[model samples]
Target: MAEKLLEVRDLVTAFDTEQGRLRAVDGVTFEVEEGKTLGIVGESGCGKSVTALSIMQLLPRPMGHIDGGSILFKARDLVVASADVMHDVRGDEIGMIFQEPMTALNPVQRIGRQVSEVFLLHKEMDKTEAWASSIDVLEKVGIPSPEIRMSEYPHQLSGGMRQRVMIGMALACKPDLLIADEPTTALDVTVQAQILKLIADLQKEMGMSVILITHDLGVIAETCDEVVVMYAGRVVERAPVLELFGNPLHAYTRGLLQSIPRLDRERKTRLPTIEGNVPSLEEMPEGCRFSTRAPEAHDEAAIRERPPFEEAAPGHWVEACRFCYAG
Candidate 1:
């Protein structure tokens, strides 16, 4: 069996709003194997990003917090880890690429300084050494004229180049794990493919595990080894990439798969869409969350109470609600 690099067990992350404490990541659980990629797929407001931020312990302070469960990274529980330990772990052991490079990058700082800061802080490198290391990382990410690019500001670089710089910074210390949350967002299709390929190639070269958070099933199919399908703050299905695509068990999963436009389908046929909106957190169902949005006809009573998440097959798990679990 492959070694597990990160194990998140029953993670419940909540945000304090005026209405009440709302759980954004309710009972989220999964594991990332060493040197393997895990994709967390869900629609907006399904708590995918919250789960990732919870693992990183980057939730907004005084508002968002991990209420329950453990984040075991390399066999150490991060839920109770001290600030200093987490600081050391952030860049040295786990690096993250934010969703948008434009917002993530420091606009005021030169590219070289921003990238080199990782080495300066984590590797204890001097100015000279950090600068050189940053150049090498930028070059490794396929950024041409790295030395010149390093001197330019964030605004001077193109979107693809900025993203490449972000990748360079995230991988600067060669961390054992990477968390890329929508790394290719807002980019053109061509640029998206390039960025995805770049990330895959880097993962192979660095032998690092990755947690990819995205709503794009196509990206998940192309890159992920294992997949977790989340809906309304809970995981509805999880399986090997091929297994999930070939045999989805949850109604929500099936609906999502059906909505994907396929070339095999008639060109003018209308694409299927899941009816109804995801319920607001304040109004979330006490039982199976996706029950409100499930397109399939089901016994309403079956979803009146929460169902147990059970292993339906080897390495395959689903929220086995009678209304949702097709199997």
Candidate 2:
């Protein structure tokens, strides 16, 4: 087996809401092997992005915090790493492609300066050298007219171009792991395809592990080696990408798979849905968080206690609900 690059075990992240401390990411766990991609898939608000933010230790502080658990990266745990240690880790050892580049990029800064800052901060390059290297990275990411684009401000560029710039910044330091949070969000279909391909190509070229957090199963199918299905802040099922697509085990996984639109004449019906919404962080139910929405959740144990994840098949895991579910 390839060495583990990132392992998140029993991660618990919470938000200090007015009502109380609400767990946004509840005991989510997954791992990324070196030079591989792990996809985190779920509906919006299912803790997909929260899980990524927790790994990066980029949670909105005071309001948001990692409450417990370990985030091991390259044999070192990040949950306990000092601020200075994490400062070195963020861009040098781990890079992140945040969603919505328009908001994430600085409107006031010229594109070149923003991208070059990574080199100046992490690589100890001088301003002149950093500018030259940033332009090279911009070109590497397929930005047309890198020199001209470097002078442009965020507001002056197209959305796709801005996104490519974001990619340039994220990869400038050649971080060992990249966390992409909804990298294809809000783009045209053509642009989305391009972005996904670009990310895949780069990961392969750099031999970097990746954590792709998205609700799009299609994206996950195309990009990830392993798949993690999350519901209400927990990993309900996890397996190799092919195993997940071929035989999803958890009820939520089945519902998500069923909801994907298809062209078959036999699929001419309203898409399947899980019926109930994911519970709010402030008001989660007792027992299995998914029992509120799972069709197979009928036994008292599903409501009285949470299901443990156990191997249902080789290299495939599912919440051990079948043992307790009455129906």
User: Considering every candidate listed, which one attains the maximal lDDT?
Assistant: 1
Q: Which pairs clash in the backbone of model 1?
A: none
Per-residue lDDT of model 2, residues 5-115, tens digit only? 888999999899889888888888888899999999998898887887787788987899889999998888999999999999998999998977888999999998899
Give the per-residue Cα lDDT of candidate 1 at 70.
Answer: 99
Off by over 4 Å in 1: 297-301
Model 1, position 238, has a per-residue lDDT of: 95
**Per-candidate alpha-carbon RMSD to the true structure:** 1.1, 1.6
Candidate 2 regions exceeding 4 Å error are 323-327
> What lDDT does each candidate get?
0.92, 0.86
- Worst 10-residue stretch by lDDT in candidate 2? 318-327
Error of 2 at 106 (Å): 0.8
C-alpha root-mean-square deviation, candidate 2: 1.6
Q: How much is 248 displaced in model 2, in angstroms?
A: 0.9
